[model samples]
Target: MRIPTVLLLACIPATAFAQQAQPETGSEWEVSSGVEYESGDYGTGTGTDIEILSVPSRLGMTIGRVQMIAAIPYHRIEGPSDVIPGNVLGLPLLPQPQPEADSVTRNGWGDLELGATYALPVKAVNFSLSGSIKLPTAENDLGTGETDYTIGAEVSKAISDKIIPFASFSYTLPGSPEGISLQDRYAVTGGMATWLGRKTQLSASYRYGENPDAAVTDDQRVQLGLNQWVGSGLSIGVYGSAGLSKGAPDQSVGLRIGFALD
Candidate 1:
């Protein structure tokens, strides 16, 4: 399955919102769309670099403490056919080795993802439980043509007015494709965010996870982001990541713009 890199960018603004005061007792709607581009060899010795351009859009609604979300992405991929796009926020699962060929490019819609999350705040700490499912909505090769499920938990605490620390863990159960057995995946992330002012926030995080194929090294990465809020409901952010192991992307950068609907 291919994961859109915009998901990483969207988190920055959400983190900023989470650090703010409690929400009003009502229903709220949010919509976000962004384009992300990334290039990396993914540690493939073939020396062929895969470039991915994704235009992802998401819609979400919150009622009480529960939030529901849906996302669909369009992707244009350029590289060797043997190299598949990996999960941007977690480990990259390697595909079965095939005969080497000239560089090829493919572009089309990616898989659809639907999810729900519930959040609770007790005193100073906030906690959340989330789950998502990936639908096989893309054409052959753009997706696995199989379904996948993920469950996660996250916690964050504000130690000061300007600083907030957070941690998250997730487990993914991926469907195996024809003639291949994919292992379950899990990841852990720890990070902190600091406010530079009332509307500007900076964040940094580290992630570690297992690759679907046990033969490869584990995934490790460090990510940084900066977000600025415009007016009351618009947010803009820039994010970057550096890979620490062979199972991760060498480098990535993305931008996101989000708007909250009243």
Candidate 2:
């Protein structure tokens, strides 16, 4: 099935809301909300302008070495046509022209995701394994309209009292749409984080992904982020990413707010 460009942009994993590599000490609940904005030209040589705005919220609970999270997102997409140049993989090739009337602006709930993670501490490093499912819950071509699954692993180590480095890899099994066949994709991430102060942290990461299908090239992106603890059990963060290849968005920005219930 041909994937929607908006879904590709919305689904690309970012570290904006990722959990710590190591499980927390005790049972805790976290609630988080965030918004993102992205705009780019994605239609082959047509220079078709595409803009996306997304608001996402997640609820998570952790106990010992296990964690579970549920998330929902709202999406608003504006573009020249419902059908874009590339398949679901967000590869910009050549634009197929539709009637001007076919262009539209649409907004709605995108998809629901449920995931679980487990962590193990070995010597000086933490190893984590996670799995997730994306449910089709969108309308107006806002989502893939199919269920997707992903499995991932991560490892992290603290080099110093304030610095931690990590690496992760994941594979996604794509769901088939009515008339299109989808292929599996994989991603890799490497990054480091350091404490700047008692209540502030800074991080940078690079991500690379194999194309989801034969229609697109692979994707590469770099992200920089800062998180600050504003009060007890509450924190806020901001992040930005720049695309390093044609398969990624040109640029994107986002903000997040989170609260933890101890």
Candidate 3:
């Protein structure tokens, strides 16, 4: 459900199966770690600049047609308390609004995210169904202090040897915390990935989503990514994003490395 980010990179390979035979029946494990940084005003009229630095680690397992992932991220946030990381929602009910010139900084582990996706048994194209949950295991004041859930569908096709196009749709139900009312969120993403060679890939994508609060504007963004497989089931990647709406961060960048084993 990570709309034009790491999730998109993960989907590209899944969709590539459209041009080949079914995946072999076996279990594979992967571990990934990355650092992501974002900066933006996030439509906060108070001119409070928000900055977030995150270091995330993920463990994944693929068995037959299903994939499961678990993620934990450490976050350092500096900005107004009303603005939270991850989804970039602006809440008016958060207590203690600092002066425009003053900002508070907090660093701790954020919520734990668990997800699973199943590939449908079809050959015409690659299709999948996925679900994820956000557990309220964050440190105090580091998260919404409530659990969240998301369900989604994705489709993709490998029309040529080098080009793959994909799309995803998702809906999220956020938990309401004390003194705050959150609305449902919906998101859609479309993108294409091109293989430059056996070991290199380039991708571009766009995403649009609704904010969890009706009073806030929607979110829109464009992203570009590059991935390179060095060898022996090890890979590295980098990505950058530009937000087109006030509800999102102005800019963000990330770098990730992953290794897989059968």
Candidate 4:
């Protein structure tokens, strides 16, 4: 499948989300939002797919260490269609994900995710557990939506005074006829953050999740980035991701900017 930015991010969070977890839920009203654009080839052979571009924004809050998260993503894809010319085209030509056809082209919002998490105290480090629901908000006809929602949990552990390692897992329900045949969504991640000098902070991590399909599949991903404090409650960073699995994309890249407010 070939498409635009936002629409791609709107697909299954498990399939297109970052290697590290997106803290979308909590209690203290910790609001964070940003835009991202990426492109990748999803599979290989006749099944090889692609999402030309995708952009997604997110916001979340933390109350005494518990957080709630919510986000919306949009995407545009181009590939094959359901016609002869479409046969020449492929996935992104028909405007939607179809049963069997000559080609399919699509562009739209993928899915909505709403979830909550709690941080457990452990020495100088913080451990968190969370659960979320993946709302059916995309053009299932295109790529994502067959599932109604999902449930998830994550853990954060500190390795050193400034470095941390974390892991997570989640489950996705099946979809209706309007969405992708999302089987289950889950991932495990290890991450770290270090103070390079003063206002400069770097974060990096690796992630793995099951492919959202009717069959059993898995995906591996790596992420790296930096965070710098600009002023009072403003900061920015650049990030990128790469996929290492047969069930997932071959390559992906993007960036993010964030602002913290009270």
Candidate 5:
């Protein structure tokens, strides 16, 4: 089955933190778009392989210390129909692999996510509390077909104006289809970012998450990213991740471009 896709790295708060020490205050707006590809064999030596291609776009605005964001993602899946269900977002929590003869391919819009984050300075650290909801806007089987909620907090501190360290923790409660009981899940992330020059930055992070399905293993991943300011409120970034556990994709890579509007 496909695993839960973690888009935390592409989210507004994470991007802002990587570019600066804290979230921007006052009034600002941003638009970003990116595409990602992931391919892996996930079926515990069953040779069940899947590939996913996704394009996610986001619009965000900051008012005072509050940041609001809206995102939509489109997904395409290719694999054996049994291993990768048609219309399912990526992979189901539990694998329901069918025979190799039932292979299928599907593509469609996924889900919509809306989120808000409130930030404040505490001593030398910038702290943010955020919450989000996922709307079941995709066609049946293309999404969970249920709403999901998440709450999280993040803290970051800068050292000597060149190095920044941050940590975040979040919990998610998912709503599943009838007869399916999905467990609550939690994730933790720790990372550091450093300025390479006046306008370039490099970062690395580790992420761990508890599996929502008892039958599957927990998730572990390591990510490396770079962001460069192209001048005049524009930035470009690239990122890659490798899975450290079976619950995550074997490898993923993506590119993003963002623009700021005052």
Candidate 6:
């Protein structure tokens, strides 16, 4: 049976809302679109595969000292379970069996986030506010699933004209009562942005998060990208991410394209 949009959204839980997958560019009234893929194991057992094709748009304008910003993210995910050896095997000498991912399902548009940011007026230092929600708009066949409403805030500071740094943290109130995927979560990250020279800009950030109610799948994410300006409003980049932990995937790589307008 095809999953309903509302039910699919409901299946995606608080965990989606709590992850810091995107970075703040703080460009006034600019929009960008990109595709991302990530592979990681579930808990310390299941192999996990996730692919996201997101077209995120941000609009920010400076008002005297503060920069007010708004953003939205839309995407999907597909996950499969893992298999291991069973504990007791005697008749025919065998190892063991453990299944992490019990089943598999494709969650389409599992979640969406809408939020606004306010940047403080400081010559070299800036602060921002981010408010958003994650719709359970994807398939939830993975067993650990729930609906959720989330809110978050973060800030960024620039060390020089060509360099910027930022950090973020947030809390969520899950709607599902069945003790869904992961748990209420906490996230922390820091990154730097710099110009390679003339028209190239490079940005990278390292993100870490913990599952508050469960210790099964804590995460450590590292991301890097190189942007080259082709014309007045056109740009492209090679982007990738990898998980650095026991239950995480080895690597994930993708591409990005963006344009700007007056």
> Clash totals for all models, in order?
0, 4, 0, 65, 6, 17
Which candidate order results from sorting by lDDT in descending order?
3, 1, 5, 2, 4, 6
Give the better candidate number (4 or 5) by lDDT.
Answer: 5
lDDT tens digits by residue: candidate 3, 1-262: 1111233334243453334335557877878888888887666555787888988888888777778888888988888755456632222223333547467888889888898878898878888888889888888477788888988888888878888888888888888888666788898888888889877778888888887767657779887888877778677888888999987779889988888776
RMSD of each: 4.3, 6.7, 3.8, 8.4, 5.4, 11.4
Expressed as tens digits, the lDDT of each residue in 1-262 for candidate 5 is 1100122347222633533533444667777888878766553344656777888888887776677888887878776553322111233443453434343577878788898887765565777888889888875366667888889988877776778887888888888766555688888888887879877778888988776666667778898888777777677888888999887779889988877777
Q: How close to the true structure is residue 43 of candidate 3, measured as C-alpha lDDT?
A: 63
Model 3 misplaced regions, further than 4 Å: 1-21, 87-101
Candidate 5: where are CA atoms >4 Å away?
Answer: 1-26, 43-46, 80-95, 99-101
User: How well does candidate 4 score on lDDT at residue 33?
Assistant: 43
Angstrom error of the Cα, residue 14, model 1: value is 4.5
Model 4 spans with C-alpha error above 4 angstroms: 1-33, 47-49, 81-105, 139-147, 176-182, 214-217
1 or 3: which has the higher lDDT? 3
Comparing 4 with 6 on TM-score, the higher-scoring candidate is 4
lDDT of 6 by residue, 86-192 (tens): 00000000012245444443333333334444434334444445455544433333112334454555555555666656566656554443433334666666676
Model 2, position 70: C-alpha lDDT score? 82
lDDT of 4 by residue, 19-128 (tens): 12333334233333454444433342344354455565667654544556676656665545321110000112222334332434567675666766565554443445
Q: List, residue by residue over 175-241, the lDDT tens digit for candidate 2.
A: 8776554578888888887779866777788988876645655778897777777777777778888
Q: Which scores greater on TM-score, model 2 or model 5? A: 5
> What's the TM for model 4?
0.70
The TM-score of candidate 6 is: 0.64
TM-score of model number 2? 0.83
Clash pairs, model 3 backbone: none
Tell me the tens digit of each residue's lDDT in model 1 across 129-204: 8888988787537776678898988788888888988888889898877755678889888898888987777899
